[model samples]
Target: MGMDNKMIVSSSPHIRSIESIQSVMTDVLIALFPVALMAVLLFGYQALITMVISVATAMLVEALWLRKRDIYNDGSAAVTGLLFAMVLPPSPPWWLVVVGSAAAIIIGKQVFGGIGYNIFNPALVGRAVVLVSWGGYMAGNIWSPPQPFAFGADVAAVTGATALADQGEAIQYKLSDFFIGNVPGCLGETSALALLIGGIWLYYRGHIDWRIPGGYIGTVFIMGAVFGGGFYDNHLMTGLFHVLAGGVMLGALYMATDMVTTPVTPAGRLIFGIGCGLITMLIRLWGVLPEGVTYAILLMNAVTPIIDNFTVPKQFGGVNKSA
Candidate 1:
């Protein structure tokens, strides 16, 4: 018995910290505080109700699926549920949210063999499903935030204005509002400040690979400048809005960082980030949809295997004879 006990003890990925799945997931949720608060302030009870319903539905679906598979527990479902809730708009119906969550856990994740085996980010898959199925509802003209959650009804009501609706005139917005997250958009994506805080926290904890975010944001900025058409006004900020206003921050920070879906090699990660950025830009600028981050990430998810094959580290003393 003593010998067996000694054999059972082991060490050596030697770094240790007081973090667990619950702790990390809780931290992520906590980090989302600013955005969640901002979202409730801007959107209202409708958005809040939708988020609650969506997350609850996600958890239920995950539990049911796991029970079916005979696997006891996994925290991924909770993460997926919360992420799905965050990306939805203020007005999406509850049924759509439920269906999207189901699809995320079933088709996008479990079918591919669950958690570490999945090839794509499940939350984005769910968001993409809803976006495709309910285009008009997802992108509506009435995007005013809820007054009850916001400090002042008058202030929340001001978010009703949007730039994309107009043909020639530009919609002006205060940078402070955008930063602080008082603008009109998805539940969690409204506040750049909150997203940045969360992202910084994730980075500090070493739970994420910073290369992916750095590459994605950098590519968007550079491409925005190249295609901006003008020098100062229309170029960078518009692209930045595309980055800031939708699921880009959430995807870049959380979804894109998923170890299973992303490339293993550093170079492969760079490729993945660049591809995500390009596709997002194309969809926003040229495609019919106003937002493209979710689809862009999923599309790149499919191509990660190819990127990894080409960029993975070489074996010792390996030689390239094909040249």
Candidate 2:
């Protein structure tokens, strides 16, 4: 028989696609453009500086780790860097951005053998590290209020608290401000409108699934509505406020929907999302922290393998061995 006619066997991932890692990461960057643009528009020059430092530091660290001159290797480092920036305050000290970004690429990703092998989201890991190591810089009532259209303004001089915080002064902002991202918060998480636009773009590109995001956002809304105590106008509005404010929009639409560091089975994905939302609300409403997206998602990431194992579909036409 000719070589063309012979059958050849391969490993488990026999399926193939036209998409490459570079192409996928490129799409993710494109989707993130609206968020980054909104961040710059909302927080001005300092936001731009923070992002540049983060992306640059992440790429530099990854390049040095691989001993390659090409810093943009597969674009994963860039993505991880940008995501890390999104979670940070608009005007954190430059050293903080550099340390967190480097730690993200090194400890969060490279230590796990790189790229597809990482069990936790690198960006969240970086955020968690900084939050724990330097709580003064990462948390509290130090958030800079957004100076929309003031590209040259010094936003860091005007500090405030986020809506999610327990401070009574933080509750003054309207829901409209939260939706349009005029309120004070993290660099990329303030604008629910921009995040929704990016989420739509990602969904269009088939980079995410509805099960995770839908379940996440839905559970958050339901829990907030039932238990939120009608502080923001009404229970429904409080639920809406919870969904619009903080990092829920960014986390539900981007982080929790990560292709890696999440479950593969359909049921497992939904369960993972719900678990994240539940833990997030538990922390936000009762725990010491005001925001919980980072730790919530990280906790769920730790149990992904178990979720998949329990939810995996049985092979078709297979009989039970016990029988």
TM-score of each: 0.83, 0.93
Candidate 1 lDDT over 1-323, as tens digits, reads: 57656464467865788777667666666666666666776676666676777767777787787775522244567677778888876656678889998888888798987777888888888887887788765663555543546443443244453333322222355556666666666777767787888888877877777789877877766776677453325767766655555567777877777767889888888888888888877886677766667888888899998888888676579876211
Question: In model 2, which range of ten residues has the least summed lDDT?
Answer: 314-323
Residues 1-323, candidate 2, lDDT per residue (tens digit)? 57779677888798888899988898899989999999999999899899999999999999999999989989999999999999999999999999999999888889999988889999999998899888888775888889999989889888888888853754798889999999888999999999989899989999888888998999999988998887888999989888988999999988998888999988889999999999989988999899999999999999999999888766679664311
Q: Residue 71, candidate 2: how far off, in angstroms?
A: 1.3
After superposition, which runs of candidate 2 have C-alpha atoms over 4 Å from their true positions? 1-16, 314-323
- Compute the lDDT of residue 149 as modeled in candidate 1: 61
For all candidates, what are the clash counts? 5, 0
lDDT for residue 168 in candidate 2, whole number 0-100: 75
By TM-score, how accurate is candidate 1?
0.83
